[model samples]
Target chain A: MLFKCLPPGAEIPGRFPGPVHARGKWFTIDIHCHVRSDKAAAMVEGNAAVSHWFLETAANEQSRRINRENGARTRLQGSSPEKRIEDMDRMGIEIQAISPAPRQTYYGADPDLGREASRAINDFIAEICGRYPDRFVGLGTVPFQAPELAVAELERLHKSLGFRGIEIMTHVAGEDLSAERFRKIFARCEELGLVVFMHPDGFTEAASPITILPM
Target chain B: MLFKCLPPGAPIPGRFPGPVHARGKWLTVDIHCHVLTPQAAEMVAGNAAATRHPREVYANERTREVNRQQAERNRIQSTSVEKRLEDMDRMGIDIQAISPSPNQTYYSADPELGIATARIVNDNLAEIVGRHPDRFTALGTVPFQAPDLAIAELDRLHKSLGFRGIEIATNVAGEDLSAERFRKIFARVEELGMLIFMHPTGFPEARRFADHYLVNVIGNPLDSTVAVHHLIFGGVLHAHPNLKLVIAHGGGYLPAYSGRIDHAASARPDCCEQIHRMPTEYLKQLYFDTIVFTHHQLEYLVDQYGADHVLMGTDYPADMGEVDPIGFVEGAAGLDDAERRAILGRNAARLLNIEIPAAAG
Candidate 1:
């Protein structure tokens, strides 16, 4: 909140610009902000898991209301780049490293569907960063259900987009992040020097406190 | 640190008084112990929802069979005062802060029924503590769904019943304790200077945890993890900094996999917007019990939380409980004599407000 954003593409001379970069001696980068990708959603529209995942609530009363209320607000000021810039300025945020919300990760969907959706999301993030190089950075996602495909996409995103990192869910479906199969994907992220941001869509094993015990 | 069972002819306490213990200076306290009151159970009879649990309904045959045997053992071992005392003596526990079982908290019943059930449950614990002042303490329960009534019960438990603390489910019905509606309950507990002991009953997502009893194994810990994370992320911890909330099952899965929480707090502005510091830092403020079931696991908890923050918890009468609880700690290399004593009794005495009587001459 203290530091303001530097003009787009401004770089400090004689200094290695790090993740936050320099803005009046302190760079302000919001590592989280959700940007929905219509392309990504369309790619995975056929998966029942993806649809079920979208409807899952972590069982917080206030959160459910907020999501409900945001639907009306979203109509007023959609996630346009210019609108986001206005918000960042209002909140005193400088550069925002953005990724799609956890629903777009598609860990439970069909592997091929997930792969296509991931590429679409990554491309969308890349274009946004390209358009506002000074104010935005891209964080990609991969089709983590199929780790091999996920690693391949990691390589592709890194080589083409030169993005800083990827956003991942805490668990892949009901599987833990530490499951042996997904270790290779993490290993690839390390090799590419990318940040793996993990966020949880809900509790593992579908453990909602509100849901009734099934017969 | 050694004891031999007292000679049977010489008034050997009850079931088994265990070996004659060596003259160890430290007292041992079992903070996580459960008792099911017969009166309360009878009251809730025919009310199936009062006792339904996801783990019970969804367990495989193997688990169901095991639970049946465990329930049988619990009935014989927990209902009889003489049997419980003998078992406590055998286990080398100096005092047990007994509370209602997770199933008997009765939060789903009508608010009036919940209140009545809590009273019966609390009275049963108080009577036990009243009879054995040195050997037992009471940890009451409340109807969390009705916060106003919950606060009143909290007051009655503390002032009238002389309870040291309370045992609460990880969530109420479906709402987390972090819900705004429940803040008054937490606020009252903190104001009254009472400890809040949290235990998990079940996880309700059936398909994800349908077999092999994972609803208890994975689901229980996950439930605690979710509740504590909400308390952390939802700003309950911030509002009541001094709330002595102790979590069951070794503080569950969060401590082990806390890197993700920290990463999110740093990346997501909203994650840390309420809290003053990183998420993992708050792990120190809370307390944990030693029912994790492994020496190395116990050692790690002591190491992470400091022995002072770790207390002895044997989920008594349950098959999953830490059998040989005192010995479990004695095996942990991380705990020296002082740290071991702190975890075994001294810390519980300080927090639970128990005053250890002078050793018999």
Candidate 2:
């Protein structure tokens, strides 16, 4: 049976996971969802200083509690592609446009470390999309603190991995997104038709209760 | 006959401006307006080599074009009090709390030059406001590059000239406003109970922003965001809880993105070394102006920050300012009469401590 809330003129695609909702008829797509690969989680775990900095400087009590719960769930649902697909199917979601969690953006890490983390995260995302082509599309992350490195990675993700876009935080190291230093990345994104998903990172100071909402 | 649109319970002030739809009985104050006095213009023009740094730092074809267009428009409208008054009347603005144009802050100049320029700008603003007290009030400029000089001038403006507030740039010679050296100025301003109008100068890091006029558009708000973050995380807000601060460009990206900061602080121990409260709580203590361009955005600001915290702002006389200040507020959905009144004028009036004439019984 078709979902009652489905919009008019819906058509179900033949390959839909279950019989109830047809692809064209009632499929739902969530454009702004996040995924956390085990490799990315390991990377965050290894970077204790940066993680501590984020927790100390960015997160508050409520966020800490939520992160503890979400962190546990992300380890299960975010890491295993099968589990993610299962969750999506249960929720009646057809496709999810997934990017790495905002905490994984890691613009504050050392430039080389940041690039390494981004590569690992982006590769993991690409692998998930490759495994479930119909169910998931991938967005990549880059070390925005180093603009040149970010642009270079953007090109790689677009050309090789086929990422549709890259995610960026609103500010880098307290520098505004409009700073001239980041022009090359913006220019490359414009030239490549790469979508830019602007997200906010935790505030720069180590002791505030302000952080961007997770998409 | 009474104005049809005035809300039923609104007090009919004895001497309000003539009726305008949805804005008849209340005073409409524009707290975020800018002015460029002729003397400050002449000073910047005459000091070509000194003033060239801001342009040269971002020398590009687009930057040149944007700067040229801004200079032309500002020369016309920003400098002329008569032009400003006419525009305010057209926009249905009753009082414009005019501050010197962001460029005139001149925080980058040598200490002496900065102080002299500030005095000239302040004197000109005083003269303009003095000429028409009912239509205008003014905020004085300070030589923030020199904090001692800035404090002295702040004292002079407050004591001698009766200025109610002081205008400052987001940064002082590339230093954030939250730096320790500037603490004295903040403390003094708090002690004086004077309003701090925090306006962004040209974004210090404008290299990527040269194209698309993003320098003013995105850059302005970003500057304010950075400044406020420093104030919050750096412990300025914690130290002086009663700063009476008003951030332009709707407090930049802070109000909307505050929840994230809270999350970061909670999950990490290192993020909370300065203050113990949620950043939004401190943010609530500060005020914002409604210059975000859309009614929905303004309404969101009002919702996020209560009506009392959001004041009416039109970047005044600049091309980027709200074209119809009154209509922008009136057009916003979900605002009741009292909310509209608060945002339109009452909030600003209360902040500035100006008494609106009560209605004649």
- The TM-score values for the models, in the order shown, are 0.68, 0.68
RMSD of each: 9.8, 12.2
Model 1 chain A worst lDDT run, 10 consecutive residues: A12-21
Candidate 1, residues A1-215: lDDT per residue as tens digits? 10112244555221211233234555678887778787777776766787656334544454456456655555323346777776666556689889877788988888888898899889988988999999999899999999999999998889989888999987787776767999999999998889988887865544453422111
lDDT of 1 by residue, B1-361 (tens): 1115555455422212333333344598888988989899898888877766777877878878878876875786666766788888767787888978888888877789899999999999999899999889988999998889999999999999999799999878767777888888989999988998999987756545656677898888888998898888777887898999889999999877777787666543335555777778776789999889778888887777788899988888676687666777777886798888888888889899987667721
For model 1, the superposed segments whose C-alpha errors exceed 4 Å read A1-215, B1-25
Off by over 4 Å in 2: A1-215, B1-24, B44-60
- Model 1, position B248, has a per-residue lDDT of 93
Best of the candidates, TM-score: 1
Model 2 agreement with the true structure over A13-94: per-residue lDDT tens digits: 2212335433455768877777775675577675654464454455556557756875774576667788778767766788
